[model samples]
Target: MSANGLVQIEGLTPPGNAHRKTSKVMLLFPPEWVPTAPYLALPSLTAVLRQAGHEVVQKDINIEMYDLFFSDTFLFWISGRLDLQRRLLEERERRAALTDQETDQLALLREKCTVEVFDLAERAAEAKRIVRSQDFYDADKLEWALNIFREVMQYISAAYYPASLVFYPMESNLGYRPGVSREVFACLEDEQVNVYRDVCRQLVLPVVNREQPHVVGVSIGTQMQLLAGLTFCKMIKQAFPHIHVTVGGNVVTRLQEEWPTHPQFFNEIFDTAILYEGEHALLWLLEALAGGRPISSVPNLMYRGTVGVETNKEIYTEKTTALPLPDFDGLPLDQYFVPERILPYLATRGCYWGRCTFCDHGQGYFDQYRGVPAHQVIEQVLALRDKYHCRHFLFSDESYPPALFKKVSQLLVERNAGIKWTTLIRFEETLQDQELWYLAAKSGCCTLYYGMESANERVLNLMDKHAKKSVMRTNLMQASQAGIWNHVMAFYGFPGETRDEAEDTRRFILEHQPYIHSVELFYFVAYRHTPIVRSPEKFGITIHKQPEYDLPLDYYYTLNEPGGLSCLEAMEMAEQFYQQDFHPWAVRVNAREHVFLYISKFGTNRLPQIYAKPEDRLRGTDSVSGLVTWPVALGEGDGNKEDGPTMTRVVSHASGG
Candidate 1:
């Protein structure tokens, strides 16, 4: 409404014929891990665009991306190649069993293999090397693995769906491993180039010909994701000249600081580079395209031309609260393959405690916390419940601030808007109020995902987590007492972590098994933008003398502690611990019940029964709360105090009878 002539929403629309718009926009989510659902970015962006009257279609390319590479055809090809290699090995073994002349003949036969077969053989050899070596998993070597994966994907794409809209999924620094330095990570440019070419030939060309979307937008969340996005954009431009392309998201917000001098950074593949939050920028770009206005003149857009890329001086308002809750109704919700279709909601942007050293969000743009109003949040919850039957909502806030949680909890209780939810919370903040935990439970809060990063005090200090082991333990116990399940996430293999320290963490988990519902263990990988990655020497750790683009696996280094596990070993141990203690089935059960219990309580017309027994009511409890307090019987003094001793106990309580 200010500059681009786009209409902004003021009040609610009465149920009637809303005028339909003609502009078509396709939004793409690149591939990522199967279990971890893609962040719900496009729905919010689409809602904004739709409010401004644009027909938007979203595609989650993750399933397709996985399918393209892991299909039966691709598997069969790999299997056949493996068989050929096996046969060659067997022939050599047979030759070893025979005369030297026979062995020489067999070697000659192997040398006479075709180019394609030889390439397959080489790939098999490399795969064997990858399986055996510790260095293969490093952050710097991730690109090498990705390149290998890309080739398989490319081969499959050529054989199958040629001309699909290929969106490269975002990659974060978490996937990086040890041994690989940043410099080695950067050297995999050629592999990325090949990936781009394959994407163009196999996907972009066909989609452009078929659907002819007016504009294609690529989202970049991390630096690695940005590289993939840039690659896709260049391919899109070269293959399909008629369509407009745009780039936005977390990476775009910091692009100016990272690469300010690159010409066509705003141009070439991208007609417009959206800055800040993209909802407004997207609408402006579309209007410019449809109305035939100069692309360079669009607000919140940076463009390129004869002189250079011109950035408008217009400062976009960060305080716009008129935005709609993400329209998931339009998205392919069922297409999302997860144990539960997690409804991700952002109550606020930025962190309440922005003092954490390792936080990129604290240092990045939108550093201040801006929360959506309570009424607005309730409205969105109602819409999700009524329309999509969504009962489980995950707060995607950096930290679900205590004040906001209290308000939301109270509102949910008052309105009787029953919904089970989980959020990341500070240990001390939640522990300070028992009422908060009780209210959270009454309002159907089932789980609290806590980032109890380490058991070691030094490691915690280095990370600036501002938490103590005792505080985390107490909060976890209180949460269990409040009937709220606790999911403890721990980071092992931090820079200064010793074997004894790792064992102590393991021992701690064993000691507090009853209070904690599940534990997820992760190996620490230094992110490029983080303080630890920047100043490794401060913590007596070595930063890899490599480029920022390199993956973690390439720069492997050892800990100073005697008999201490390397980063790779520590990561594997943590993964094993997670598998043993917090299996996938447990997570699924928690996630599933998180929604089902809430919906059962709210959707049907019966008042939810809070207590599990009649005696609970007799105990003068208003309603039976299913608070899961750990019996003090399992603690240090009350139990057989020997370490590493396993015992099973069956206890009967009279209160719940």
Candidate 2:
């Protein structure tokens, strides 16, 4: 058992053919996600299954893979793999000329091999310590630690050339298109570039072998995690043919229409897939697997029958008010890369404003929107806070509805919850009250992410956002003046949007740059299920679908008229905005959790020290200066002496201790 009484199962004796009342379920959260906190899906599913009197062992292999990457054992293993690859390339060169790519890779391998593995491993371990201890509050130490993580990822990426593995942003590509079914299947079997296969063998298979679970469910939440989640499923199915393997999450839900035709994916990769909300659907599936109910009666399930792939008739949507608090038992919460524990809680399901033209996030839900009342939200928040001994939270809501936003803020203030929180919100006119922002900040609202998709009023009308420039400006001004960090998300391209309209957005952001603390700019994607793609003619665009992308959720597109920016122009505009106008939001701390902690620690949004120095930006990378390859030594400071200004000491009574 762990220190907090959470069950820490290393292994279990193999289950015999004995009968039991409840099934043993092993829930796995795969890699390529943010490693700072536990995802809410596993805990949400685990809560229901355990409440139904079943056994569950929830493993977060995402954080484990990251944890493993920076360890002495894994680094030494990477060194050996690099050596083996270098020898193989030398042997190939003896017979034939090396390809350009192979020649460059061999040079990289030799250069990386020169770094002292023992020293790197020691620094890597220390980096983990720095992030998990009081040293994290020191910006200099924390920056050095984060650089070590990036360097370690660079070393590991050399083992699998052309994969382009990365540490942050979750953009690691294994040189395979996840949207193509054949390439997806091929990626699962590739021995050379598929790092997830090794991750599964090292960290996942042993637990499955020892626990002998009756069901293994993998949650593939994002496109980056699809390869890793499917790899774990395929390997589990191969090792134990009897264990029922299932996959679900937002990405899986997006591809629900394509799963029925992919029979090879149904039986070979995973036996079944749960769609939409999975709490009760998965529980009912367990009942079916246990012979208590007919398999056809289970809701939101897709499986292969004798006639081929079969989806159940009933689809399930969860009621937000009726659900239990997400149970985070059996997860190694302390192992996250933060000094304090930040728990994720969902107060609402689905986007409240479900009319964005370029969004497919609403496709994951069968229903539009539902939320718990403010009273119950506070009760649950207090319960979770006291029970876990944590004061920080990430409200994982799609968008904080205006009514609940005010009431929840009032309750947090009146009840004195002592909780620091952050969530995504819409720029509603109802939130125009400046006092509301202050109340929220007093109630410990450290950051708010807004989906200000476009500042052009005409473009906003086209996208169905309908947000007024006045309200958007007021929201940013009030929130920032109240000392809350404002993170604004905007994209450059939309169908029927002119170049002048896109420039309007750029000018507005630059004019209001002080209010917007952080920004995420991107070119719009023509998602497969969005309203724009459903009626391309209405948006004056044509979506070009590739035949190979049979399981596609997004597409390339072209404008039907000539006034708007082309796809290439949109890409160039976004790139230029970052290169020329993104200095104000270029943060040294990029991760959301890291930024949240910094905001909470200082109790303000104007964190000058956290912003990158002008010279640092000129260096063209976010790592510690001169530490990319090899450095003679790391600097030492409390971020006060010669590094920068001294940080205000705030007592963070968080749960990681």
Candidate 3:
């Protein structure tokens, strides 16, 4: 304790003392940069490069440009464009209108439009301040910020393609749908209304020019990031033709798997494209690039050759323990829309249950099952917590393994990691055990996103989720009762799924509203290399020739038995279920996991009443509550000490925890 009863808190400092280093490189997560947390790929890559004695810089343009986007300056440009268009429309209508009613309506329209534009501008300014300020986690203030984004996006969506401030990588003709390279170039050529293109010019170019990095690596994880990533590469290559550009991530790996089938578009955009785990491959590539060795020697990479695309076989590493700790040294971690920063840690690589028919997660990122030992994960978690002054963490794994997760949970209870965390989990026998769920909560497990693809057992089997409806429902309640935020990711429109089966999903949610905190439901799309597409006849569907898209697409057409909910029907059902009924609290699922964590920490939950203090919680089978067993000596005081393993700091509950 301080002699004066005042706590001394050290500020966050970057790891490297050197202001800048030669052999410079820059890694970026392109727009729309998620404002929730820093992307995991860049930091992991940064750590590897820094360990290799290369000075690597990291940037999340998603966040940087977002600060710029939500200002009066951006709004001013948008509002001016909106006003000009609307006034021109009004003039066109007035030229033909002579009636008093028409005149009144047009006059009223002008009045309303003026009021709305000014109101929208004010809202944008207000949101910019709150988000850029310290009070970002306040739901009310956050809502205002959201409103500003939504309004600005609405205008942009009208002028450009339909854009969104909600889900990231907002819909563009350039992204999501599959096409060849020429189409991609056409979209990039459009400078007037390409939102992501503008992001590249304004935000990315200047930074690249200043740094003049030797290599510029861009991370494209989701289908959404496809266009922006491609655009990012194009801009870098055009601006600094000498700078080597590499594109990689889950999305890149998947696209590379289908390389032979697709036209030769990738070679034009990036110097090299990395597939699957790029750790060893990238390290070798960088070494070779710097050493003037044969670039063809780099495995897991497709490089442009003098004659054709030169492909290399990827070297696989089953043991994940050898990788360096992910470094978040260069990001503005505090600026994410949360009171406390949420650090993303990868405890494992790939899924243990690699049998899911609908999922391609196992195809590359989680190709073979591997995980760091539980003790090591906890050790790293503790180290990261201490270093960053962050207690909340998000595990960026395909699904945390049952055995590993349980072991970590128990260790967390013992060590009191003093950390709240969330992860994607498959509903299995291990999780069904209520005791393990309780242990998870005590270890500070705040949210678990279960892939409840369907509540209908038949559809579940068809999708190869392999989870029984009854069992999953029971496990959900147990986890919920244990005081963990049990969120779900559900989907409809599997090959043989009927509307009735899809409705059963809704029935499950309604039946377990108390236990289930949130859900993300949608129609399932067939990605290339998924089981259903690989063996369409096995699922009683005919694979149709799909149109080539500018961006590599995840979905293709299927001539299936007409019993399932069509994609459009599924969208309608989601609108009815989430928007009409659930509204603000129960909303559409975005990539933001921090929102769930914020809700758990800052918002209300039933845990405090249900969970007993550690002491009262029984060590064995007794009438009590704890993670697994409430130790007899563990009272509120002891429980408090055991639960908070990290350094102590003063926390104010004035915001209503």
| Residue 92's lDDT in candidate 2 | 82
| Cα lDDT of model 1 by residue, 548-596, tens digit | 5333212334554455457787767665664354321122111222223
Clashes of each: 33, 0, 10
Give the backbone clash total of model 1: 33
RMSD of each: 14.6, 8.9, 13.1
lDDT of each: 0.52, 0.79, 0.62
Which parts of model 3 have CA positions greater than 4 angstroms off?
Answer: 1-22, 76-122, 129-137, 155-180, 257-268, 550-552, 556-594, 600-657
TM-score list, all predictions:
0.63, 0.91, 0.79
Ranking the candidates on TM-score from highest down gives: 2, 3, 1
Candidate 2 lDDT, 1-657, residue by residue in tens: 345332222211113424435899999989876788888889899988888789999999999999999999999999999999999998888888799899999898889889899999999999999999989888878888888888888888889987878766365779999889999999999988999999999999999999999999998876767889999999999999999998888788888889988888987999889987888888878877887667887778899998999998776667678778889878998999999998888887766787777766656677657788999999998998988888999887767788988999999999989999988788899889989999999998998878787899999999988999999999999999999988777777788888999999899989999898877665777777789999999999988989999988688999988999888898788778766777666666657788899889988898888777778767655453221111110011100001100011010000000
Give the range where candidate 3 is weakest over 10 consecutive residues by summed lDDT. Answer: 633-642
Candidate 2 regions with alpha-carbon error over 4 angstroms: 1-20, 622-657
lDDT of 3 by residue, 63-156 (tens): 8767666666766666565566557657768687445644554454454356455666677667766654655555556544655565566545
